[model samples]
Target: MSDFFLNIVEDEPQALSPEKVWKVAVIDDEESVHQATKLALANTHIMGRKLEFLNAYSAKDGLALLSAHSDIAVVLLDVVMETPEAGLGLAKAIRHDLRNFHTQIILRTGQPGYAPEESVITDYEVNDYKTKSELTRTKLFSAVYTAVRAYQNLTSLAAGREGLRKIIDSASTLFQERSIAKFSEGALEQINALFNINSDGIFCVSSAPKNPSPELAQYLTQHKHVDLSEVDNDFRVIATSTGYRDLFGVPLQQIPKKEVRQLINRALTTKSHVIEDHHIALYLDTPSTWQACIYLHSQQDITDKVDHEILKVFASNIALGLENTKFLTQLADTAYKDDVTSCYNRNGLMERAIPEVIDSNDHAVLYLLDIDYFHEITEALGFEYGNRVLNSFADKLKDAFPSDAMIARMHSDVFAVIVPGHGQPPIKRLIEHCSNQPLILENGDALRLGVTIGLSIHQEGTQADTTPESLIRHAEVALNKSKEQRRGSATTYDESLDAGSLERLNLLSELRRALSSNELELYVQPQVDISQQCKVVGMEVLLRWHHPILGNISPGVFVPLAERSGLAYELDLYVLRHSCSLVRQHPDLPPVSINLSAMSLDRGELLDDFASIMERFHITTKQISLEVTEGCLIKGNSALTNLQRLSDAGWDIHLDDFGSGYSSLNYLLRLPISTVKIDRLFILELKKTQHAATLLTGIIGIILNIGKRVVVEGIETQDQNDFVANAGAEVVQGFLHYRPVPFLSFVDEYKSH
Candidate 1:
């Protein structure tokens, strides 16, 4: 059966010139009608192309043919084909369902009553509607010719739009290339897209001259492109398309084709384009003494003057584009690279070097190094010596690491290096070498320095998308740990080291929500007068956070985080305003004391905000007392000035957490504080040993002798209370006297009394 089918296929006729024919589909139910149509248009030709008719017997066959051939230019349809309106239905399927809007449809019907011409043209989107009786040979020829012309225009517009889109996409890609070679290749691709041609080409660049302009010199210095001018001034192929790819990087004189070389030399000498019958060459000059040329080959002869003009414009633009790319490259280098150490700067390491290293290697380790006690060196010696030490250390880094390794100066006295794999032996050797060698200054002074190193390794076979920023941050965290535990040692990053940071971030976010949502409240713990039969002298206001998701966040955890995050100032303001409003509402309550953050003293506007809040609530400075830590007194003259302003404004100041940090007795005389609260640590130790009582007694006696009211805190036991009461403490604050309570509860218990 297969042999018989092959024999039948061999007997069929073949087209004379298939490539030069325009496809036309003829759909009808009668065989005679198909033969009649073909015979009538047998000698027909339009736009120098002959018609090749495709015959389909029924609507089903016609739809199948339309679906199989998307390039069909026109369709001639009979209205009644096995159904009353089969041809109209097929037209709708072609126009709507298949979305083949490019193909023109000409509907021909024998009976006008079956499907009206006006209805079919308007509803089915057919190009033309004609009755069979009116379609003679002359009219049929005109109808098909008109339809084919419309299809041609539609396809032409679509092709033009596609070409324009490709050009736009290529231009975007060309601007992102960093090197001349890459830029040349991108320009070649875009030029081919613009002309809708796939011809072969070659891009060549001549060497630049020595001692370029100052602008070019600055660019070259920043980008490290000075080596380009060192080579001999000869033209070399930088990029090529398809057949000419083997010519890349080859000198012009060594090219095998003498004719191509002669054409290139002619264009270079004249500094003008050479247009030929089947080829074109363009010459371009850059801002420097460098020149570039492009040679393109085509099969057809050059014609259209518009195309020639566009080619010239494109060439000029290519020259401008090259200069713009050079400027941008230099700008990027200056932004990210450090000129002093010839290493990547902080921006360069994060944006360029780190990404390249991660892309090329499977596993790598990042080392964060810092010069220990660098400030002391600068203070003792001069800044000149400090700079010399930094330069010497940078040299040591370059000598120790491989060429492919990324080295950068993160900031002052801090350098970072990224190496492959997770080994410790090389790092140990590097440290020993650095320690043994001392940097000798120009003044003949040898300075010995120590370094702290932190290492973070990205393991193999892990997630591929880990960012360099996160790795650097983790390494810095480890470096901080090294500095705290052992100043001159190295530590590797671990997941456990990130717990505190992660928790702090989560708590900060929750604290912000708490402040905005009114979840923060003040709890007051009363301070009793021990000599006045345990009378309630005053109440200390404490901050409390009630979070919806994490429940109550302890003041100990969130307060320090708030201070470090700079949110302590806002929290302090909130406490001040709310406490003052409460005291104003219930005048019978004792004087309230609120603790201020040490960070608030550094801010120049703290006093102003405090005064504004007090005036807004119609409360006086005497009604509220501010408690500041001992650390604030020794910060600077600014803190002292702020405190003196508060004291002059009739506000009472009390020293809080005394003797905890830098416990200098000088603060008692220097600060304008009316009361002192001994640190809880000293109060807890009063009953533990004999030295504790003697020390506590002596400290309380000294404060009383100085005429400053002393308040002993953290009295949990009766013995502790009795000792403090007899030891000359005017007031006591602890669980033994009263625990902290909410504002409403405190008002109900004490204010009603």
Candidate 2:
């Protein structure tokens, strides 16, 4: 990574109160806003919690922070950055991509016109919408507090709901325990942890002897602590929150309070519960062999009637007791194992496999395998069938690896397995089996599976074995690399891949800087009207980067770089805005055509921005032309609609790179295009292949027949220029006629003309 990207790394946040701090993220492009927000919210508290601020100066930085800090309670978001909708885009990413629905997003904007409050609120789950100008320090503080409270309330409700669910599950499990003594203990613990209380609970179990002396009965009822040798003979405390360790396994009768003994006896005799102001003793409806009672205490009142009733009903049902151990195992399995496949899940992998790999003295290899086109399969077949297929896959995995080997379903169609030692993992064989072996579903539908595997090996005593997180991360990177190459391919982690990624990030950082600096410039190449003795007709605008160290960089290098870096929209807007300014300044210039990416058109916002730019520059649509390729047709309805819209608004639309594949004659006739620029490849290949010249001539003739003008691209020789002129091309753009010149030079030339 370059120093430019280093600027995004924020300083470590100072520790707030560990137990009672709401993490709030400030995501804005302005440094002043970050400082003001920090000052305004310095001492602000909401829901008995002080605020801890995490600042991100850009939408990209904000997203990275959100991903890292899942505990963020609220996001103070600005509505514009590189583009008008950058903040909105980040909000969508948070909800859909990050799967973070709980974080309250208070959308703040400097310019309200760019974002309509009603629509943005409806669309992006905005909690509170405010403009920067209206946000007085006091109002800002109040707004944050309100949103923070909403976040706290929402999370509390979620936690409470989850707690209730666990309580019900544990309560049901309590009744299913086979042993009467164990059953009482389970109920006592569940009641203490899950219900509306925060004090100790004790469960006592008793079994009457067939024949016993007075001394024996007295000794069983009240004596010493229970231990390994002691058996359940009479009533005894199974569990209690007695502070002294020595009192833990002692007899229930040893407690100083007379109510404790009386309460247990009353509940046992009545076969019900004895409730008091501070404590409740419930009788366990266990087997006839043994009797049990659970004594619980609450410092606070059981205000909720429903909770009280549920606890009583829960204590009343202990007669089931069938397969208790198995039921508990399944409940535990649901947490760590996949519900459908019954294999380990991601949590299971982390707990069980990560430690093994880090601790093992033997070499270990981790395989991250992905099933290709799994989503498509689910879409075509039903999700039920997809689950069945997953079950089949899990079974195969079990059969392939040893029982002790760690296998887990990381997520969706992705599975991971760590095979410790050089045991010959049989990974290749497993892939072969999946490919050749058809999975016969419950409905008799058979489908074959294809797998892609990414492997990361950890040699014992190597630095890689120190951290399982890096091992897993490397495997994920390898998986992405494998998929990028093609599906059903295998890849191993390599350091070069990381190097290449860092290089790309550096390039992206540089490009972002170039966009703002004067390092980027638009150049123009004149088009010729051959019939008018090769007179200059129009010009096509081109973007170039003049890097400080590496002068005159190619568009081929940076154009796709901008697209991949999520800066394509910004770059397109810059070109359109710059071209409009050029046309505005030089009133004598012909319609200056500029390229707009199909991606921008499909985004559905850039067209309006383009219109706004034109209106700002006082330039008519006729003064500037929008050029696109066949890629526009496939980018869906938005691109096609926008092309027609621009043409209808009196802007010229030229279909650039014609016959570069994907262009159809039917589409050509239907689309509202005035000019077709044949791809440069034909001109480059004219001398090499006679078929090229024939094809070029045929395409030009067909374009002219439709009443549309043709622009022959990439001509370098007089022969090629003359050849295109005779082939019905009205306008010719190439080095042979007029080489590209800087925008400033083009302006000077026009003025001189």
Candidate 3:
């Protein structure tokens, strides 16, 4: 059944012109009617064209044939096919369901009484109504002739309206296109639709000014023009349609066809339209003094004078679009290009070059290069000379790399490049060559520059999956490694090098979960006053996290991670609020010291947030001592203000890790600190050497003399404890007294003690 429907003849095999064959579907259940219809149309001619019959045995087959051939001009439908009203049903489906109003339907019936002619014509939009007896050869021919003519006119008008719509839509879109390559391609597409031809063509623009005209002055006010002074005079093809797509960016002289080249040259030289046999070239003079030409190939001749005029108008619009696109291109260049070196900037590298390299099929390598000791060089030489050196170095990089390579200035001293893989050898040689010749400044000063290069290769299959950002990150990791080894060195990234980064990321994710899930616990270690027979003075609050999978993570490991990830502020607040709540719950416990991160003091709101938490827990400020590192005090006036605000609120701000950092005594006087805790390193070394003991003793005396209490940490053995206690340390905290315990256990132990 399918084969029978597939073999339905919609065109005459022997017809000289298939376009002249009016496609007519003869739908009926009777095989005899099909044969009779074919025989009647065999010698028939309508509107000086032959009739092509399509056979359908039933209404189902008729609808299938109509679905297969959208170009069918007329349907000679039989009313009594497969059912009583099958023919009427198919006619309604074609007009209503398919929305195909163009194809003319003529209902023919053997039984005249089955369907009334007038009602069927009005309801189903049927073109003609006839009984088989009345549909004689001449009558049938007449009916088909009228229907085919109507279909032809309707299709022609639809085509014209669609063409005009495409032109208007294309013009609006072309004005918004910023890329020259994309704009030129879209212009070719619009031109093809405007001409109603699938012809091959090329869109080319003169690299420089052609015949400069005064008419271009009017357009300059409305559009930007490219500077032609730096451009060459050759005409380059920017876009091509279909068969000529490979000719894009090629010179006009490279075109193989002499006739086409001559047409383009003639159009460009005259600054007008050139029409020839089976070809046409329209030239547009842009405001930038550049000539834009579109050469089209079509077998159909341009006989209509109106069409030629429309083509001229289209050429003018294309010229304006090209001018607009040129302005957009200039703006993009300014945004993406570095002003100092004309290389791609960080924005360009990430937005344009990196994506292109990653999306390309070929394997590529990314090289991240940093000028070693660039800050020192900039300090030695003035900034003006430094900029000159950068520009000269950029020129050398451009010279070393291929045209396809993407080079960008990622930072003040760091440059990145993406090139084809296996480029390390050439890259190494280029660096060596650059080092041999020092960059000469404007004042004839020669400055030698050293660079460290890191390489990351992206191949089809590698264990370390590469994205645009990951590739650059991996290369930067390797670059740091190179800088650590020596100047003027190169290193390649390996999976092992990135393992730590991956682990850090995972740890950050887990730490966030731990905070939310109550996996983090507060442990307290008692601070004992050594001068009063080891009396418990206060307790230090410490944070501890036990992962469900990794068991336990040390504060030393995750604390720095939290600080770097900007999570330290939240962590410190959690510790502060939780420790205060514990003290509020147990009024008998001694004062507890809560350590705060340096980052917490960066914002002014810290003091307010701390006071709010203290009020919420009903804990007094003096009951909770705030301990911050010595480094926090040197962070600027903001930290000082936060500390002063806390101290003025009657909170004791103890300087933790006092001697760990520079230990600038100026901080002791400047900051509102009431006590100092000696760093563990100093306490551990107290009994090891006499110099350590003397240093500890002197630091303790200075704290006491300054009217501040002293707490020394990490006292394990009796000798070490005795050494610090005799050294005038008021309080000592270490395993020698007690280890950090859970809040409940610490409370129980404190009560017993």
**Predictions in order: lDDT:** 0.77, 0.72, 0.77
* Best candidate (score: TM-score): 1
Separate clash counts for every candidate: 0, 0, 0
Task: Predict model 2's lDDT versus the native.
Answer: 0.72
lDDT of 3 by residue, 1-753 (tens): 000000001111132454677788889888898898888878676545787888898888888899998989999888876788999999988988778877888888888666555666766778777788877775676567557755654464433444344554454455445688888887877777777766678999876454443444333322336453544447899988888877878899888889888889888778788877667798877645567898888767654422764575567657756754664465566667887777899879877898887787458888888887676566556677778888877877776677778889998989988886555447678677567767776677787777889988888776667777788888988887787578798889998877876888899999999888778999999999888988999999999998889998999989988987899998998998889878888988889999988889877789789889988998898788989997786665666787888888898988898788878888788778888888899976755788987888898999899998888988888888888777777689999999999987989877886
lDDT (Cα) of model 3: 0.77
Q: Which ten residues in a row have the lowest lDDT in candidate 2?
A: 1-10
What's the lDDT for residue 630 in model 1? 80
Error of 3 at 388 (Å): 12
For model 1 the local lDDT of residue 722 reads 87
Which regions in candidate 1 have their CA more than 4 angstroms from the true location? 1-173, 176-179, 188-270, 274-281, 286-311, 338-347, 367-404, 408-416, 423-455, 463-465, 469-506, 548-550, 630-652, 669-674, 704-707, 725-727
Which residue pairs come into collision in candidate 2? Answer: none
Tens digits of per-residue lDDT for model 2, 1-753: 000000000111124454778899999999999898888778775545678999998889999999999989889998887678889889889988998877889888897555554766666667777789867775576566546544543454333354445543564355444344465456566666666466567766553432333544454354322231344435666555553234456676686668777887788778777777777777664322345677777777654522654554455333222122222333344456776776779877776676766586467778898998786677556788789898888777777776767888999999998877787456668778767788776777788889998888887666654357777888887887788778878888888777866777788899989888746899999998888988888999999888888777789888977875678889988898788777777778877888988778667676688888888999888788888889877766656788778788788889999888797888778999888989899998888999988988998988899898888888889898889878877788888878889988977877786
Ranking by lDDT: 1, 3, 2
